[model samples]
Target: MDALTRRSFICGGAALAAMATMPAVAATGVKTLKNGKTTVDLVANKVLAQVGGVLELTIKKYGKVAVVRTSKGVKGFSVINLACPHAFVTVKRSGNGWVCSPPGHGSEFLLNGKLKVPPATTDLKAIKFTANSKLLTID
Candidate 1:
């Protein structure tokens, strides 16, 4: 309505937006395996976790996700997209169903998100998980 009011409003709006994008992400999902695809459709507040069992989930909203159940009853999870972050180019997908691309220099990572190749020293970002009851909640 006024100059000062407008400036304050704009600043407040910008801060709120920036905060939203900061990836303070909270997420939750339920998964079902179908045709080799584990579809994850749920709220961000729900977490993906290992609750004495395992689940494989593919989250469409972010990218492709992978989960594994260990022999010791442990669960592992990761997020991957074959699209290179630098150029948005499609990277080679591995037999393990992992995206093989690096952000900066030419480095490679394992499907489990471990660092492999060099020149780039970055690993894949992990998909956070939490557990409640028998549910594996991924965020």
Candidate 2:
């Protein structure tokens, strides 16, 4: 696997591990649709920012993929998770895109999850986006 994939694997493992301690219901599988799409409100989801936009959503038991911009007009959007690859920190948007917490400064990322500097080289996991008149799919 490439360095970026390795990072994702490691971090993804950590995320799974963290979820292990939660209640079974928290980890229980939901209506995970392969061809279904749902809209997530960043503000309601508690992943919003002043300038940054959310890219995807995970229904815990469901699978995951990176969120991408579908169109180029008013409906255009981008999706991303808030987890940090370095130390599993719950990152946030510092200025425009992303910034890690715990007082260890200088860790920033582009809105798309590219490393802005050191300590984090892997970009955020992006999901697939498929849209049409009948449906908008995220898988």
- The candidate maximizing lDDT is 2
Using alpha carbons, what is the TM-score of model 2?
0.48
TM-score per model over all chains: 0.41, 0.48
Tens digits of per-residue lDDT, candidate 1, 11-120, equal 44544455455333333455644533343442232333332122333466546444433223224334444444433434333433233332223344565556565433
Q: Indicate the TM-score of model 1.
A: 0.41
Extract clashing residue pairs from model 2: 55-78, 55-79, 55-80, 65-127, 66-126, 66-127, 67-127
Q: How many residue pairs clash (N, CA or C atoms closer than 3 angstroms) in each of the candidate models, in the order given?
A: 10, 7
Q: Which candidate is the best by TM-score?
A: 2
Q: By summed lDDT, which 10 consecutive residues of candidate 1 come out lowest?
A: 45-54
Record all residue pairs in model 1 with backbone atoms less than 3 Å apart, i.e. clashing: 26-44, 27-44, 27-46, 28-46, 47-137, 47-138, 48-137, 48-138, 49-136, 49-137
Residue 64, model 2, lDDT: 39
